[model samples]
Target: MSGQGPMRVLAAMSGGVDSAVAAARLRDAGHDVTGVHLALSAKPATMREGARGCCSVEDSRDARRCADVLDIPFYVWDLAARFREDVVEPFVAEYAAGRTPNPCLRCNEKIKFSAVLERARALGFDAVGTGHYARLSGSATGPTRPVLRRAADPDKDQSYVLGVLRPDQLDGALFPLGDTPKAEVRAEAAARGLVVAEKPDSHDICFIPSGDTRGFLAERIDEAPGEMVDPSGAVVGHHRGVHDFTVGQRHGLGIRRPAPDGRPRYVLGLEPVSRTVRVGPVEDLDVTTLSGADPVWLVDPPSGPLDCVVQVRAHGGTAGATVRVTADGVDVALAEPLRGVAPGQAAVFYRPDGGGDVVLGSATIAATA
Candidate 1:
């Protein structure tokens, strides 16, 4: 994607202002750009109005209209079948196994980068560009070895979700809007006369457009009611399903009694087999060590302990930590305890480089202590 000469770029547009601006930027940069809107939903009529995020039927039309204004070829690729098999099913399975899964990250990994990029390359496209708020750096040679970096706007930085990408995916990826702030992008969209300039950013999971995640999961998986117990295994309350809870959750636990110390009880663990929701003081949620599986490295895999920043969630769960590469996975020693580190969530490691903390790599959390 780091070619100075014009290159054939497949721009993944989700009918959002960010994507529209991204495609326009690429086109202005003189690349042969084609806009593609991925159809992830089998039944678009059932989705929310105006395609919030990337799953709605209206999203395709919006993307088409943007392409028309930019005077570029546009196509809607139906990836619903693959989306269901790769992203949706795994999401449900993770929750069923008593863990929280970030489907947005999964979509970026399985669909946008994997499926879309593969198809684009088969059709002779050089790279795939998106509106993701991340930067790409490269060498001076013709075969630009692109390296992923953080965006200028920290609030809208999406490097965490894109952390699952490998070095090859990095070479095939382009983030045109990375250096630009989001406000400037919106302004550029309006100036360009794009239709989606003012479209509100989609925050909810695209599949669960209604934003009722628990309700959605309940419909997919059978309810296995269970006991809510204290750290000592004393039954404090009852839960309808262990899948309805997650580590560090303090609300909607359905626990009626206050703790002996009069503090709100937080969920510490979920045992899906026993359907047990273990609750205790908030302090119990804090842990210093975490093990992550199936690591994907952006840089050379470390042979020994490495110091970096650790982020457990999409936003705000961050700590300075030391990472040790293991035979099966990675062992992290947090400089300070982080609360609610749960299995199935990606532990994205970053170097403390002032340039947006370069994304070192990521691994799925397998266990925590």
Candidate 2:
């Protein structure tokens, strides 16, 4: 907490217990804190009923109430247009291209840390804090730059999603809930008389409020009927659209015929040009080598091959790998074969030391072998 003396901080309050407590904690720590609720939705008030999503008007009101209780200034910033362009549109497009995209990562990369942080700096704030469950070590004043680490609460660790942030962003970033447990955060919110103490966490994409990602995409992209084919290029069934299936998907494929071996078939790949959905055995999903494009390193890129643990998805297990930084990306050779390696998903690299708790950097998966 050194170098945090009375500096102005902008706390992104998401109308949840974690953020409410984060704002309160920053205030108590003597930082000149202001609470900001990002209005990222353009939906009319009538359409926001039941408002369980993060961008709902009800959530904004809740964030304002928390700021009032903490005796801090609160403001709502409209970023709906930017959110649509940066997060929402890309999410729909990536799925349309037959790749699973993490909108939270996109929001963190393009909107939250990039857009909001830049604006906060322009407004004379020293740093921006969030309720994210990730830890940071080192100081801006120190020789060593700050590094992102896993939260103490393993179940709530969010470093994987934050791997896209650069070192410059990490310098002015604050994660108030990083060292605290989720249960303790709720308890503190209750002690502070914050109403969001018992508020359930929003687990789905904010833009897709009803949690129907397929339906949301279906409305945006034109439906193109395609053939569901086996690995040998034989037609098995028909699919409404290529976007309806993802790699490693087994259920909800609408395929009536089971494999000849009387086993379930899993989606192996998607051919958008031919509009073919390829289904194969589950073993075909395993891959030992993965190559990723558009790499973003939190620290300096290594000159030679580096041993690390790579995580392919949010809340997924890590696999040991050797990473070689390439011109366009990084190539990862997994020690053990990993299943369900999907393009367009993040392949976050972590230091193998300290039980793989430190985030080194990340890249978008491009191909697997």
**Whole-model lDDT per candidate:** 0.89, 0.87
Best by lDDT: 1
Clashes of 1: 0
Local lDDT at 66 for model 2: 97
Instruction: Extract clashing residue pairs from model 2.
Output: none
Tens-place lDDT per residue, model 1, 279-328, is: 99999999999999999998889998989998999887999999999988
Q: Write the per-residue lDDT of candidate 2 for residues 1-369, one digit (tens) a residue.
A: 246467899999988888899999999999999999998888724233353456777788889999999999999999999999999899888878888888899999998898999999999998888999999876544566888999999999999999988888788888888999999999999999999998888887888778777888889899989999998888999988888878999898998988899989999998888899989899999999989988888778899998999999889857999999988788999999899888889999999989899999999998888
Model 2 worst lDDT window (10 residues): 44-53
* Each candidate's clash count: 0, 0
Model 2: lDDT of residue 63:
93
Each prediction's TM-score against the native?
A: 0.96, 0.96
